[model samples]
Target chain A: MELLKPELGLIIWTTIILLSLIFILTKFAWKPILKGLNDREKTIAEALNTAEKTKLEMAAMKSQHEALLNEARQERSLILKEAKDMKDAIIGEARDKAKSEGAKMIEEAKREIDNQKMAAIIEVKNAAGNLVLEVSEKILRRELNSKDEQVKYINTLIEQSKLN
Target chain B: MCEYLCATKKRVIALKVLKFKLFITIFLLSVFSVSLVSAAHGEEETNSTAPTEHNESKKEDGKFNAKKVILEHISDSHEWHFFSYPTGDGYKDVALPLPCILYNDVNGFSFFLFNKLHHGAIDGYSLNAEHHIGRSDGEGFYDLSITKNVFAMMISSILLIWLFRSAAKGYGARPNQAPTGLQNLMEVLVSFVRDEAAKPFLGKKTDKYLPYLLTVFFFIWINNMLGLLPGGANVTGNIAVTTTLALFTFILILTGSRKHYWMHILNPPGIPFGVKLILVPVEILGIITKPFALLIRLFANMTAGHLIVLSFLSMIFIFGQMSPIAGGGISIFSIAFSTFIYLLEMLVCALQAYIFTMLSSVFISEAIAGGHDHDEHAAEDLP
Candidate 1:
């Protein structure tokens, strides 16, 4: 029976208490609590977003670095190939120039040798003529005094030069 | 996908913490409320006047009025009565009388401490054995007096203010840091009610109704716990308290109701004319019954919990009246069973508070679900 009687004072008091409590809590407690919770939530979300962005950026930078290295590697190989080709061309040109110069020098030496040989032969002939004249003069001196044979050899050479 | 799954795993952990925290709060709130009662009981013990000698009167009669004692324990009174003690000569009834305020046609407002009427009638006002104040002249008057239940509420209300105010200050003092102590307790409960109770039903409109829901939840929760303490007022058990709580939900439902709600109630869609005639009245009845169910559920659960506990305690005295030996033997059973029952009641306190708040949000959501216009707005919002 006592349980059934929902007292009037209690009802009114409960109404007043609850209404005021709602007002006060809504104003003071729930507002800030909710706001703080929301702010924290926003911060956490932002952190996760930044983390994801950083991870993507890092991956992009890694790929970009790899691409730059590959370009540099290709450029290096191309420069090496060009240098090898230029070295081979320069070496071939130098060898050809040296070979032609050596051939020309050998031809010039041969011509000089030929000229000297000719001069030597002419000298030997002159000597040989003098030697024949001397031998004939010796034979004539054996026969009749040296002065008369020498004059004979000189006269013979003079007549031969005039005929020529 | 990884990120979403991680978030879900975090949410599950967070929900566990919330439940644990809410558990601490109600349990701690009971202890806190009981401490207040202890202080009051101590004061009343020193201040209580001794009754005229009824020394060992019950022993002489060998009769223990278990029903009267248990009912009085569960009911409200004009004063806070702790217990009765027998001295060598007389017995002592420790009670703190409250100020009585009444309104009648003859007397607009009369005020006095309930102790004034302790001895006899005062100014034609008399207190019945049931602790109701009535006029000797047989005139009905409004009892605006601060009864025991009222004082208990006042204490809890003040405590509520202090707690939440401090929590609000914690929010100000520390904006984004994790909650600690009382602030943490309040936050967990607030979030729980928001997420588990309001958000599930009210959805985006959760913030709009969170305050009222939180208030009623904490009110019922704290009061239910307080009532479980020895000699605490059965505030939530009282039908009046639950009715008032229900009235708040009913008002919210009625006021926040959109046109579509009434249309659905008055003329449910896709129904024939004959079916509409039958269904409309049932739908209207449904509106009233929603809150009524909220009221009765909380009131009955709280009242029954107290009743079972009190009945268990009464068993000792009942068996003691049979024989002192039987009483001594059964006390272990009574106390052990009652302790187990008491723990069960503690859970029911949380359960009842939860049911009341959840059901309330459900009703409010039903009223405020404004129909397909929201979907149309969503469609219109697309590029």
Candidate 2:
């Protein structure tokens, strides 16, 4: 068929049209389109890089925050341990002070009781001695009524004691 | 989880059922339309032939030439023919006559509408039986008219320009903003060409030849798409068009070639002198065949696709000549097959464009790749 035949005029026209298309499109279309595409690609790559960096930063910050929290927890437990030890020491000192004061009061009471007992014994002894002396005085006064008879009897007794 | 799986399974079943229903509906509709069209054709043939028995004999003489019909449909013509309908006495051709510009040595140049040639002759120039313009004595003349294919090319180019210009404007308007509509689509294609086609082969030099690659890709792709439409010219299917495209690639490859490339072709390394004699011719042939293959591959592929679809459509008429019922039954299958081929052609449209661009870039890069390694080696030796 004539259709299979490539005509010269059509070939020339096609070449002209294609060349013009290439030239025109290269200048107006593909240039800008490619530039825009490259720009977008670069932007996307930069954005992804920024996101990765930020993610790393965020992870670092998160670990740092956990470390700081751990430090605060350790400090809080240490402070709690110190506070407990101080409270125990204060309570023990108060108990020891109270026990010493009770012991001192008991010693003072025992000394006072001993002093009272000695005083009472001394008073009893004085009273007994006075009573004995008064009895003896009365007896002697009653019995020495006859002075001569008594003196004679004493002389006879003294002579008999010298002969024997 | 069980619940969710059950819900998903129900949705899948529902979707399958819906798809089956849609397929059946389309099948029935196609069959119905086929029968209706065959019936109308049969009636028209019978009615027209009954009035004039002599005309019937003449019609039988011509009969149905499928090859001619298919070729005529696929070939570039002086006019764009849409579907014609039967009028009062005969079928009228519904077509747009393009301008015919012819030049010859004697008459110098002639300009007239293509419809003028339909009357047999104009200004000593006449359209041959094959619808080619020549001298009345049947001498070959140069035709520079805007035929169907050329018009299609112009239209496709204009469309490409408009589309990309608008897309470029969109990029300018919104520097970093997201693209919408045409800009979005153009960006995807542009990026695909840049990233997939040009970058891989051209490497660092992709920017240098990216414009040509992009233009060729979009031009071929757009023309292929246009060829698929009804009443559209087979722009990409024509050898002239493909040759022009291949010529551009050939030119680029030649112009971009470095000294190393010529050296490799002339005196290849690692080959004995006796072997070099055989290898050099083959290498030179290889150079010519690269673009030749590009030309033939695209032309043949696009033309074959169109031929296959046209053949499928032709089947309906071929079977209809046997019997109306046979025609009607075949029409459904033929139309279905053609529809499938049409969808496949859509993929081929983009694929061929991509292949052409990628191969062109590969060729150019190969031509320029000679001194690149030398430079790299030199740089390594330096530092």
Candidate 3:
């Protein structure tokens, strides 16, 4: 019973002290402390969120860059393929044109050679006929010196003509 | 892998066997020493008790009273008792006297140092067996002196203020920077009280009640820790201190309660009309019991811890009267157990403070919560 009793003065003092303590501490200690904690939390959360956003942006940019690089590679390969096909077509056209030109040039040269050979053969034939006529006239003039020899030559010429 | 597992298993078995052997050896040694000491103690007890028996027959001055000694040590006093030893004629008490303040209707006011009353009565007021002040003519007075408990409370309160003030000042100096030293430690405790204790229960109103919860938590925790030190007063163990704290909580709960809260207590929902007759009284009793339990729980837990440690220490003196060898042997075990309990009390110091504040916040929140239906409507009605 004695131990359970309360002292009035102590209670009064304690109440006074505790009330003042609550007021003073609430004003001085808890406000700034809670504010600081909240502020720091907000800052850290903002930092992390910004970092996450930047990382996502970087990933998107990286994928876009990869896509652009692939397009460039495709364009480069397409240009290369077209250039290769053009090169092959141009070479084929040039080779065909040179072959046709060379064949036409050879046909003209063969025609020119044939015309020259025909002209030479005709000239040679005319020269041979004139020479034969001159030789025959000379013989006839020598042989007509004697009538008998002439009669015998005429008869032999008639008989040779009959045999011909 | 199999081979390795088998080798490890064999090694483990060997280690376990060696540990068991060592344990048995220690157990046997302690048992043998205890029995030998008890045997020596029995002969000395008879020799010592004979003189005390003679002294009791002649006079009661020489006999030892353990209850008186223990109660005196645990109870509040007007002086701080450090230690006492035997002098040539009698035992001398080494203590520092505190101031005593008294006010009476007849005597007006009286103030003096406590040492003046050591010999006998002074100014019609004297200290009784329990160290309480009383008049020689059986009169009463208002005591407002600086007793050991009050002194200790003042010291701990001053310490708490200084600690938090410095921590708060540091926060003020560097508002957005990281905490260092004392600020860092205090921030942990403050945040713990807020997040773990206050925020879970109080919710949006946490800011409003946080100051009180923090104060109670730190006040109780600091005083509990201080009480564990040697020659320190048991402030929290005192009924008066706990009662005051309980009253504060009672006031808060009552004042903060809404109309719906009382309605629930008076006429509980979903209960039959006939049951209300029995339930209403029980509900009201429940309200009173809540704070009563708080008062008893803190006071009993703190007091029991102190009593148990003192009992362990008292064993050494009790055995020393029988024989010095028995006392020495028992001292080792008693002091070891006391040290272990002392460490456990340190953990209880923080745990009990947390429990007190946590429960207070829960009660306050429940009172202010009103009715769920009303709250839902209030939310819906908001623009």
Candidate 4:
């Protein structure tokens, strides 16, 4: 028990030092350190806020990029459609022009055929009259009639030929 | 214009004269009151038989029946002892055992040594076999007397409580609020603790333990400083003080032990069974060693400071008996060295306290965070 006295002294001194320190530090030192800590907290918060805002902005930019991509796809599809429609229209117009030109050429050929038939009939009548007159003259020569009578026959033949 | 100026100057002179007279009167009154009170107290101290009577009562209480350490030191010094109201002459004579009269010798008989069981005095001093009674005279000044050490500790605690309470009430975080008197001093101390001590050890938890750490820091510092006073109280020089503090640390570490902490200490992973067996004992030893180290560090620092001071002071006495001239020369150098050590002691006092508290907090934090668990071994064994 007597040996423990030293331990008691140590305890008492420790208590005094502990109490005094608590008093001194709480009064003199805590505020500034606390303030510094708070300041650090605020700075961290600000940094977090900035990071959040940047994240949002990046998200928005990504969406905008997606919209642009969609627009490009739509534009490409529209251009392809427009090109196809233009090609079909041009083909239709060309087919119509070819049909009209073929019809006009057929009508002109029919008109030219009618004119050639009329001219051929006139030429055939002239040639038949010439042949009959030549045949009548040959038959009269073979029968051997008098000179006066031959002259009269030739005139008659011409007249008959003209009547025929 | 000249007439007006002269009139203003005359009025100013009159006011100054009145202020000077008022100041002188106030000063004289304060000085007179102080002197009167002191004189009254001095007379009372001389006339008071109360101390002797209290000392007799304390003697009856069975304190210091054994070799009284405080008395030993004082007696060795051969100085005249006196007592005040709280501790009168008899009360002073009635030696208070270390640790608030928790334990003391029976029969109220003081002696140099007693041989009860062993039937022989070890080194001509009383021997208690049950208790590992190592003398401070051997371990140095810090281990000297328990009562004085505890007194110093208590005083330091009171000082801390007072210092912080005032600061907390007076000033907050507002700038331009210049700290007046003690408040200014307190603010500086707080800053030093936060920046220098608390910041490094505890980091994020630094803020949580700021108040406690600061309390410890100033308390230890002030006591260490007080120990260096002329009479050489050497409260910090006691091993018991450091041991109690270390015990507090040990308790904190155990209570705050986390799962991870236990795993690391008891069943460390990535090591073989054979190695672990070797390591387990060592690890357990380490746990005990932490507090032991803390005790030694604080005890050694405080004791060293006292020894240096005492050694220098002893030169004055030692050489003074031989030759005054040689003694005077030695004392000059001694005083200079003592002053320098005193300044260092002031820092060490605070530093040691901070280190102890910081390490304690870290230990507790590790435990409370579930750092260590015995079940970890079973979990690891499972396929």
Candidate 5:
């Protein structure tokens, strides 16, 4: 009977002991230990989330960088083509201007050379005419002194005039 | 690296110490068993020439009554009796007789050591033949002494406080760091109870009930372990302790239950009226039985475990009544078998704690309708 009986004292003691144990453990034991575990869990989860976000961001940045590099490559080729076209246009314009200027200068030199040749010819003719008149007078005077010599000289002069 | 080396070295030392302690305990238990049989043998030798009726009367009294001893072992007592040694003339009990407190209408209160009332009476209070304290006049008085179970509970409570507070201190000293040593060990148990027992059932309300759940788990487990010590008091095996624990859970259920719980119990939706009639009563019975089951299951398991181990240990004496040679030979087998049961009981200690916490969580979760949505979804899926 004693073995089976639940003593009121033990019941009271158990109740008191258990309730107080729950109270004390709740305050000191379970609270802090659980808090530590929870805090650690939360930090771990947060760290994982941050890591995942960072990985995504890195991937996104990598793709953005690739796109930027591609755009730069395209822009460089376009600029290079524009520069080559401008160089070609400037070279062609310069070559054409040099050719035209050279031709005009050569034409002006040829005209001046022709004008100098005509002026030289005119002066020479005037000089030759003056000399010829002097020589004919001298000859007429000399022939009056000698009639035969004059006639002969006149004939020779007429023949020479005709041959001339 | 230093840490690791230190830990391994500490573990080896601890293992050695544990083995030595186990050896000493087994050796002491064997001595006690031998002493018990020798005492019985002495009684039998003196009574051998006596008449049959005389011997029969003396048989149960002094011939190593295993039942009495086993019952005494599992049962609570006013004294923490360790063991007895035969003195020059008679046996002297080597035990700590606890103090007693008594109160009645006549005498408001009386306080004294248990031995003061050993002979006759102390201030109108006497401990009966069974050592239960009672008033000399046979009137009722409140027996409020700290019995063996109470003492054991106190020790376990203090132990739990010390253990967890040290872990708490660890967290306090180094927050958000990896746990080490005792803190690590405690974290394993705490995390286990939370993840395995509390969270799976409680869900969002896991934190709210953690203290209660954690307390129950540690209390039962620590007490169960304490009871496994040589001559340790059976704290969890007591009905009072389990009842109190169950009552706490019951109160929590009552206070925490939601409307859906009652709705599901009292009025079922889309069910046959006749089925509702049957299911309603069953659901209502389920409420009380949840806690009741928690109470009986723990008490029965712990008590049965102790009973088996002690009964196995007592086998030597039971056989000794037949022959001394048989007694000596069976002692070896009894010790081995009992040691096996003892190790099994160690596992049962933690297992029973887990079961109690799990069932409590299940019942609590049911009451609070914590997993109502999941259940509803499952129902939809099934249909």
Candidate 6:
């Protein structure tokens, strides 16, 4: 028989070799290799997903922190405003009370001074009246019942009242 | 009256003889005509003549010779250097020559190693030298000779895997850490492969095949790129190389196939009984055809580019044989054209490699997705 063409021989051998290799690879190499590959892939993917998760978590934490910071700032401002308002209110109340108390004490002191002055004036008027009455009685007893003397005493009394 | 009748008959006979002489004159005149014979011969020769000089010359030179040309073509493949480097001691090119010298020897298991050791004695015309793996050119017992391209492919693959693994190891638990050097580059490749190639088709299963897919992608791409280099061994261009790689894919797809995968191929779901008969066979055939297409696409694309380049180079030699001036012009143009094609081939090599890996990953995804739904689907189709 004529020898096969080299191309043909090559083909036959290639088929046999490749087929057998395929079989062996399928049986032994393929599964383990692919499994290892798959396992590696899974691990890598898990790593990536973890990275993604971490990134998201970081973002969330950042926002939460910002919110907390903002709330604290607002609370601080509110406390400052309230403190200032309380101080103003206390100062306003104290000023209003001091003005009213000062005005009331001054009015009461003036009333007491007015009552003593009125009592002193009344006593002086009484003493002056009694002294005038006694002086008139003594003068009338000593001077006799003369009409001219009575008229003169009445004139003196009128003149003294005018001077007082 | 009888004598007068005899005189008239003699005259009539003399006239008849003169008429015969006129007929002979016309016949001789026709035989001597030059234009008529010449025109007649011209039309006849147009229909029946053989031995056209142009065709005969071509036949003598033997055009369209598939057998002889194929051998010459195959032999030309042997001339390709598997690797390249700059010419000198202690240079990077030094390592390149090792693979080339090793690839040229008689192929065997230890073929590459032995050639590297015995490069001093080897030369042209010694195409069939004694190989170290106990096989000579004539023996043909073992053709397991690892070509330089194969070795290069293996080396490049190992490097790529190592780079990626090292990159992954670099990621610290701290969030603020930056990846260094090769790690950064590897991160880009890993992300691109995952996001662009595998993730779209494989979806959730994208992670399952990422490493294998990445390895295949780089392996094929690097080898294909090497093939495009001048004097480089076209490992991917070899049908055996493509076929072996394709076989691996085939096995992966087959083994990873979920039950639903088989059902879709053997008995599709949600089809009427009558329709199922037609669709089932087509689906089954499609399963086989997908991988077949992968094989042919890679083989044909790789081989065709090489064939075109070789054909262009052959033109220069053919023209040179005819005339030096003609050869010079043709060679210049051919070189330009070959350069353009080589650049295009570089892109194609990477594309084909990526396509192969992508398809393999898709197949795996489909297989894993098949699951229990396929059984129910197949059962529903049953009469």
Tens-place lDDT per residue, model 6, B56-128, is 1211232323333322332213122332222112102122323332223344223333334334333221222
Q: Worst ten-residue run, lDDT, model 6 chain A?
A: A1-10
Per-residue lDDT for A1-164 in model 1, tens only?
76788888889988888888889878887888888888878888998999999999999999999999999999999999999999999999999998898898889989989989999999989877886686666555655446767677656655555455
* Model 6's interface RMSD: 8.9
Record all residue pairs in model 3 with backbone atoms less than 3 Å apart, i.e. clashing: none
Q: If the candidates were sorted by their DockQ against the true structure, best first, what order would they fall in?
A: 1, 5, 2, 3, 4, 6
Candidate whose lDDT is highest: 5
Relative to the unseen true structure, what is the C-alpha lDDT of residue B213 in candidate 3, on a scale of 0 to 100? 95
For model 4, the superposed segments whose C-alpha errors exceed 4 Å read A1-6, A9-164, B1-146, B172-181, B199-208, B365-383
The per-candidate TM-score of the B chain, in the order shown, comes to 0.82, 0.86, 0.82, 0.57, 0.84, 0.61
Off by over 4 Å in 5: A1-4, A59-164, B1-36, B43-60, B270-278, B370-383
Candidate 4 local lDDT, A1-164, one digit each (tens)? 33224444356546555555545555555654456445555777888999999999999999999999999999999999999999999999988998898898888888888888878887877777666768665755566577887777777776776687
Candidate 3's residue-wise lDDT over A107-137, tens digit each? 9998988888888888777655554454445
lDDT of 5 by residue, A75-100 (tens): 99999999999999999999899989
Q: Candidate 6: where are CA atoms >4 Å away?
A: A1-164, B1-140, B172-180, B269-283, B371-383
Compared with the true structure, all predictions reach lDDT values of 0.81, 0.81, 0.78, 0.57, 0.83, 0.58
Sum up the clashes in candidate 1: 0
Give the Cα error of residue A75 in candidate 2, in Å. 11
Instruction: Say which prediction, candidate 1 or candidate 4, comes out ahead on TM-score.
Output: 1
Q: What is the DockQ of each candidate?
A: 0.53, 0.38, 0.35, 0.16, 0.49, 0.01
- What TM-score does structure 1 among the candidates reach? 0.73
- The residue ranges of model 2 lying beyond 4 angstroms of the native Cα positions read A1-3, A51-164, B1-60, B371-373, B376-383
The local lDDT score (0 to 100) that residue B189 gets in candidate 2 is 88
Evaluated on CA atoms against the true complex, candidate 5 attains a DockQ of 0.49
Docking class of 2: acceptable
**lDDT at A50 for candidate 3?**
100
Which of 4 and 6 is ahead in TM-score? 6
